[model samples]
Target: MAKYKLPKPGELSSSINYNPPAKDWMDIPVEFKPATYPAAAKEKDLLTVGFPNAHQWTPEDEDWNLPDGWEDTVIKGIEERLSKYRSFKLFMDVCVRCGACADKCHFYIGTGDPKNMPVVRAELLRSVYKRYFTKAGKVLGRLAGARDLDADVLKEWWYYFFQCTECRRCSVFCPYGIDTAELTIMGRELLNLLGLNINWIAGPVAACYSKGNHLGIEPHALKSNIELMIDDIEDITGIRVNPTFNRKGAEILFVTPSGDYMGEPGIYTCMGYLMLFHELGLDYTWSTYASEGGNFGFFTSNDMAKRLNSKIYAEAKRLGVKWILGGECGHMWRVLNQYMDTWNGPADFLEVPVSPITGTRFENAKSTKMVHITEFTADLIKHNKLKLDPTRNDHLRVTFHDSCNPARGMGLFEEPRYVIKSVCNNFFEMPENTIREKTFCCGSGSGLNATENMEERMRGGFPRANAVKYVHDKHGVNMLANICAVDRAAFPALMDYWVPGVGVTGTHELVANALVMTGEKERTTNLRGEDLPGKEGNE
Candidate 1:
């Protein structure tokens, strides 16, 4: 029952210069005090009396030395590079300081902090940029609250920049469409350049660079995992199927995320891909060479992103595939739809995927002529190509959580919803503002998937869970469905914290679970009418 105040519709502007009186210290709320650092007694009581907890931590050890030449060169380089953009200039010039973006931020809403305002959050980096790069800032010095490089400022940048999930929820309501997400991305990229990346992100980035996949799963491990998933698919569907691996000269290259190969939720979606493709008699190959489509580099640097995406093009070329199907992933689709076509691919050898069943052409499809699995499935259902049992998903009442990357980054709203509705009869929707483009984050997207930020993650998850709680109260939404791997990896933890019984799963899991065996397995009164062999009326 969090009360959220919406911004007055037409009042967004940075230049309005309307300032409220400073807070009266006498009348200040006790809850509004800054969180004090915990004392030694509190820390000792909280600490587990174990071998690891015996070691004392110091402030000097807590803060590391600055990178070589960071202050003189790298920092200035980023400030200069980002300064040249008129878009960045528009962002600086147009934000009306109306605080329209204030309550819209989950971090602010959860913390009730005025400084966590999206505009104020961007100011963390924006202030640095202004001080170093702008004329007004150069002349004014500390008057504009800008300062030169110091360890403290850099540390603050690391903290606040990472606080942003880059969900773009704030940008949706911005009058000038000023994206704080982009600023946060730039801030993170700049910090990453100085070797300031968080452990969780740095580990994955390094793993992606050296090993063709993140999670450090090697090619053989990846193949074995895929094989295991294929076995599970067979166990459930009673269809003995081997999903092709690294098959040269295949007509289509299905590029799923490494997460699907390595983790749950996504792995189920991977199995669904195997079943659907096998049913359609499609010729496709899974390439270990281009094992990952989920790029963390998108949250970091564009250059590093290109380095990551180069694999997709390289693998497609090596396999000689006509098209590559991107699996159910959010950022992967964002990179594929927005940047991959232009960044690292011509994909000249590929053909625009024409539905062989309908003769409809997929045009302007940039890299490897990509098609989202949901879109492909929806089109098949549209053409009366797949025989499905719409009532199979009735056991679980489901609500769709449209991932921000797919919903706003790409206009992929209806396709997934259509696929969901076609496969599951009892599908429900959350509040309108909390779905589609206005959807809140699962609190772990855009690299906040870091294990270190559990408390922050819960705070960020508040808005989405509040929305889900409302939906569950009214419509009994038993499970939350989304396509993003980050969402899958993140929401279960949040559900455990906020609403104990509620569950989260991939969209494809619901579809694949509900898939009719032979499309006529004796339609029952409830859900699980004609599911796989051992799955009927069972968990």
Candidate 2:
């Protein structure tokens, strides 16, 4: 739990100040407050993932207990990455510091911290890059905006890099199109070399590595969780959905974040998936081995991300599933669309995904050989393959939130909206500036959604909550729909803190609510056991 209680909405909102302070950003030292940042990664979690310098340390202590030659390790890690990724070097070199990205970051908008500005955040690393890697920086020193890589600078890197959600909204505004998120990724990678990682990220990475899911749910436990959802489906619809796990020769392999099965609200979304699959008579199987669709390792380092992501393809091949259907998640799709092929490529064993129901080939996913659930559902709705009763969601005045990875990384704008409008009677959009490619992060993304950092999470989520408040007040929106699991887990707290009464849900939960399944008894209550609009008396 957070050490301090969050202020009321009025005081918190009134506390934001966008103005920069009198001193240069470099002159300002980072203060390690208890609740403002996430806790340091535990030694055991670091050891589980084979990270270096496995030892106990707190961010507040002057001694971080870095291993001998830790500075050399970070410098060499930066040099290796500079030599490897062209984008890293290009981003380091190309920023003109025009301040176009200063106001664009949600963290900057909410916290009013100058270092949270994307340009300045990138400069935190670029300063070291300039001092060590560039001739001009080596000659001119501070004159060229270069600073030495010292312990204080490393601490600053740990603080601010973890502060970022890696949402990439800043990259959209940059004239040079510098991806500040990738810069943060690189910064985190360097930090990982010295075993400087947050518990929120490292714990999940370690769990996903050994237990095959972020929650460390064992194979039998994973099956039990789904079976519980199956039982609930029976209770709601009077229809039994028997989903297979680790079954061989299935036509499609279904993968979703473990939260969808294990966590509240996300479990409702999981029920939606089971109901939809049962109605379609689709041939799909779940894998306990590839249980987690989200790759928390992406928040740690690229190598760790690849290590965690390899399980999906491995499971797909072993099961002999013809194609893969992914559930709603933010960074999972980013990894799939952008980095998966490069990291664990070819997916030669699996066939290109074709909707068994609609017969529409997913040409977009031909290479990745995996299709998003919304893309699959939108196609089904397009062909009128499933009967739907939109009024089941009449109780919800719904608005769609575009998860950052899908909107920016994958260009998935209309499919989710199309699905949402088809299922719900009343659908509204947040301000155009706060949606689609320009969407604000849910604030607790990229493993920043830890309980210890409640204040920070609330601060970062303010811009997004403000946008939701607009539609909530104007359009009477009661439910916020999104495709990301992190949004499902993060938004409830955000809404409670910032805009009370706006509930969060996944897209498919609404879909299943509106789905008119074959031979289903009168659904008096929706999946959450809430009464339908006119069926209130019956429930």
Candidate 3:
């Protein structure tokens, strides 16, 4: 049985005012109407600033003043760095301003401001690039309205680009197929160099640098926590789930976010994996040394991100694991599938994974033979490898909330859905706009998942919660199923505040419910074919 902890009343003070007679940050009245766009006036229209750009673009403003004697060196370094990728230059040269993607952003929908449109968001970064790298800016100077790097422009970059969740939702609707997420990433990287980084990211970045994980839990602490979880599992099921720690010569090494060891919903998923692996008798080891592969540093700088990724390969080499398996995570999978193969690995010792049961090979495998938990589970089910009872999940009227990272960032559109379908019968999907490749964010994504960003979260979270509210009202949907650990950790608070009584659960939780026995009485359906298995008083 799961342990419960009741929340104390008013335990943590909120910065945003949520009630009438609003006090400081806690109770401000919500503006139900959408924000307005900047209205166009008479100009030659050589440069088109969108309607909502009016708020952020102060044309009267002066350029940023560089620190003494560093301006030329900084400019030259930016040029060199920008030159490394031809794609960045291709992205910059390809905007026609057709306004096709204006309504495609969750932030734009929530705010109703035209500038929050993904096109405009990309423009914020592109304009700066044009000024610094192009011949027109260097010769025309002030006449071209492109100036040197200044504190004001850096501040604007921090404010607007960081608002982007980098979900790649914008890419689908762009006529030119521009990806604003890439722009936002590059913008954040440049800002990190300027030392204007957000505190939430900076804290995690420093922690990841010094302590090997974003949460700063050392190797000893990670082992201790996993051991506690293993003990709890054994005590519940009388099944020993031994996860080898830092063991050399293991066939497989597993890595996950440190949040899985420390946080609630994530920990439950951790238990589910442990239970499943024990049942399958898989050979794997967990390394406290490379406890995290989800680089929060990726949101800040490439140098720090490269360093973080380097640790995963280093630890894998030390363990001599022929392959690695990724836990159910959002950005971690994206980083693994998209970059790790080229960034830090050429693991000549490792080969593509083959199903032990079917003898079929994963011909398209990337670095260290990484696979998401859902794909593994779905494959196991396909091979008829596990015993499951779907009736155990009748209590949950669940719908899948495809996490933005895995759904859109990586092309993992089918695996999680396959896992959900195999394990539960009561599953449903949210509306098409809020599902799969078109899914909305959990609001506090991209390292903004902090108590300090509560107000901003509410502002950003409005659109996603509104989508959920529509489904709840229409179909009485009560539960959300997602795969990403961060979505599970962050969405609950948003639901509690905006749409009261709704709950979120990870996809693995439902899987565990169907399989694992917790030493408590198991629910049984009464005859007459009624849905009474998990009715009241069962717990």
- Tell me, by lDDT, which candidate is best: 2
Q: What are the lDDT figures for the candidates, one per model?
A: 0.72, 0.94, 0.69
RMSD versus native structure for model 2 = 5.8
- Shift of residue 88 alpha carbon in model 3, Å: 1.2
Taking all chains together, the TM-score of candidate 1 against the true structure is: 0.84
lDDT per residue as tens, model 1, 1-539: 99898666466565476875477321222221122111111122112111011223222244444445676654665656556666666786677777778788888887765556798777766666667777777789667656566656666666667778888889999887999888788777676555555545545666777787667788899888878877666555666666788999888888867777766566877777777777777888988778888887676677778888889988888888877777888888888998888888687877787665556677646434888888777788898887777555666678888888898888889988898888777778988888898888877777777665687788888999888888788888888888888888888889888877788777777666656645333433222123433345763
- By lDDT rank, best first, the candidates go 2, 1, 3
Model 3 / residue 454 / CA error / Å? 1.3
Task: Give the least accurate 10-residue stretch of model 1, judged by summed lDDT.
Answer: 32-41
The TM-scores of all predictions, comma-separated, are: 0.84, 0.96, 0.82
Give the per-residue lDDT digits (tens) of candidate 3, residues 1-539: 99898666665456557655525211122221222111111121101211111122221235323345444544665676668866667788788878887887888887765557887777666656667887886788655545556555555566666677777787888877788888788876665444445556666666777788878889888888988887766655566677788899877788877778887767877877777777777778888878886787778656667777888878888888877777877888777777776788786767577655445566656444776778778888787787777777766577788888888877788888888888778766777877788888876677777675565667677778887787777777677788877787888888888777677777776676577443433433221122345464542
TM-score of candidate 2 on Cα atoms, chains taken together: 0.96
Task: Please provide, for model 2 over 374-479, each residue's C-alpha lDDT reduced to its tens digit, 9 standing for 90 to 100.
Answer: 9999999999998999999988999999999999999999999999999998999999999999999999999999999999999999999999999999999989
Per-candidate clashes come to 4, 0, 14
By TM-score, the best candidate is: 2
Which ranking of candidates, highest TM-score first? 2, 1, 3
